[model samples]
Target: MADDLGDEWWESQPAAAGSPGVLAANANSSDALCGPSKTWIWTELNQRASSLQKPSGDEEGRDTEMMQQDTAPVPEPSQETKQPMECFLTQAKETKEETRKTKKWKKKKISEILAKSEPKPGTPGDLQQLIKDHYSGSRSVIELEELNLPDSCFLKANDLTHSLSSYLKEICPKWVKLRKTHSEKKSVLMLIMCSSAVRALELIRSLTAFKGDAKVMKLFAKHIKVREQVKFLENRVIHLGVGTPGRIKELVKQDGLNLNPLKFLVFDWNWRDQKLRRMMDIPEIRKEVFELLDMGVFSLCKSESLKLGLF
Candidate 1:
C-alpha cells in the first residue's frame, strides 16, 4: 500500500513547461524508503532522458534527407540567365564594327577632297607653276638678254605655233637646205627633245607636209637597242635627231651623234605627261637632261651657236 501510494504520488506530479528532461519531487517521500526509492526514481528519470535523446526512425531519415539537400552542389547557370550577357557581348562587337566603318568612310572622304583640291596641269596658273617647279634647281631663271640669239634659231614670243607645220615655218623655214649641208658632213645638225616615242613620231610625220622633206631618223629606245642605233648613225648622214633624253645620252656617250653642226635645242615644253609632270618635273628625265647638258651640248650656247626653242 505504501509503494502503491508512492507510485501514485509520482504519477500525479506534472512536468513544468520551461524545463524539458527535468524531474521534480514532492515533499511526500516521508513514507518511502530513502535509499532505494530515490535510486529507483532517479533511474526512471535517466531512462526517460535517454529515450528522449534518441530520435525515432522516421525522424532520423527526414533529418538525413535535409542535410543531403543542403550539401548538394549548386548547378551551373541556365541558358536563360546567360542570355543578357551574351546579347551584351554581341551588341558591343557590332558597335565596334560600325565605328570602324565610320572611320574608313571618313578616310575615303578626306582623300577625295584632297584629290579635288590639288591642281591639274594645262591651265594658265598651272603653266606658271610648272615653269617655276622646272627651274627650281637652276642657278638662275632670268631671261637671257645677253645672248642675242638669232631669229631663225628659236620661235619668237616663246611659242611653237601650237602645231608642227606652223612651228617648222616659224623657226626652221630653211631646214631643208640646212639639212642638206649636214647630210654631206654626216653630222647631226639639230636635236629635238620629246617626252616619249609617240610625240617624236608625231613630229616626224608632221615634217612630211612638204612631201619632199629631208631624211629623218628616230633616236628612241623602242623596237631597237641603243647600241644598235649608235652603230647605224655612224654610217648614216642623220641631219635631225629626234628622241627622249635617255636615248640621246647613249648616242652622245658613244660619239655617234655629232654635235659640231648642232645649233638648235628644241623642247616639247607645253606637253604634260600622264601624271601632269613636264619633262623637267620628272627626276630621272631631269637627271638625264643635266647629263646631256654636260656632254658638250651647252658649249654651243657659250659660242653663240646653239639656241633654245620651245616646241
Candidate 2:
C-alpha cells in the first residue's frame, strides 16, 4: 500500500519544465540563473524608496520658501506712516523761508560818513547807533569844552588823584565841606560807571570816609545775578553806585536805580586801561550805555539837571 501511495504522488507531481513555480524556485538557486529575473524586484524597491524621499524633498523646499518669505526685507514706510520725517521736512522748509526773509535786511548807513553828526530823530535803535559811533573813535574823548556841557552840575577833571577818595575830594570839594552838616546817611546820589567790578571796587575804596565808616556797595553784573542785584539795591541805601555799564543799564531798566533824583553821573572818560579802552571803547558796554541813555538818562540830561562828569 505505501509503494502504491508514493507512486501515485510521483504521478500527481507533473514533470512539466514550463511551470511558473519551478522556474521561480530555480532562479533563486543560483546568481547566473536569477540575474536578469531579480532586476524587476530590485527596480520596484528603488522606485518605492525614491517616491518616499520625494515627499521629504518637497516638504524641505516648501519650508525653505516659507523661511525666505519671512526673512525678506519689508518695503520702506509709507509717507503717511512717517509722521516724524514729515515734521522734520516741514521744519526745514519753514527755516529756509525764515532765512530768505532775513536776507532782505537793508544795509546800515555809516553814521560818520554823513556830514552831520546828529542822528535822525526816529527809532531808539537809530539814536543808539549814532551814540555808539560817536564814541567808537580812538580819539573820542569828552573834552571840558564849555560848549559841549553847559549849565550842568557835572565837572571835568584832568586826571584821577592818587586814590579814589582823593579824587572825590578834588571833584566834590563843596560837598565834602558841607557833608558834615547833614545828619542823615547820604543815600546814593551819584552813580559811578566803570569798565569792570574790580575798577568799581577800586573807585568805591576811594569813597571811604577818612574819619568814619566806608559805606560802599558794588553793583556790577560780574559774579552777581540780576535778581540778586535788584534785591540788594531795593534793601540798601546805597550812597554811590560803582559798576559796569551793562549792570547800570539793567538797574535803570528794572527801576532798581532811581535816576530821577540822580544828580551826578560820573564816567571814567580819559582813564584807558592797558588796551587803551575807555568805557565807550567796548561794544557790549557801549551798547549798554546807549540802553541806559534811552531809559530816561538822556531825557533827564536834556533838561540839564542830571550832571554828567568825565572822571
Q: How many angstroms is residue 140 displaced in model 1 relative to the true structure, after the best TM-score fit?
A: 12
lDDT by residue (1-311, candidate 1, tens digit) is: 75867667756666742235244342344355477777776677667766677888999999999999999999987776557888999999999999999888874443465478853323333333443555466635463222223444334333423575676556667877776666544367677787789878987887676325566789798898977887777777777777899988888787777676786777766666666666766778777876786687555666767766665
TM-scores, all candidates, are 0.52, 0.47
* Candidate 1 residue pairs in backbone clash: none
User: What C-alpha lDDT values do all the predictions have?
Assistant: 0.67, 0.62
Give the 10-residue window scoring lowest on summed lDDT in candidate 2.
118-127
Q: Kindly list the per-residue Cα lDDT of model 2 for residues 1-311, writing each as its tens digit.
A: 75867666754564334444544544554475366667775465456556654667778899999999999999997776557888999999999999888877756344433335632222223333456565556324442121132335445453433345565666666664333443323235667888888788777666665314324567787788888877776775655667888877777777666777666777765555666566666787777876786687766776876767665
Error of 2 at 267 (Å): 0.6
RMSD in angstroms between candidate 1 and the native structure over all alpha carbons: 9.3
By lDDT, the best candidate is: 1
Candidate 2 error regions (>4 Å)? 1-153, 160-163, 176-187, 209-214
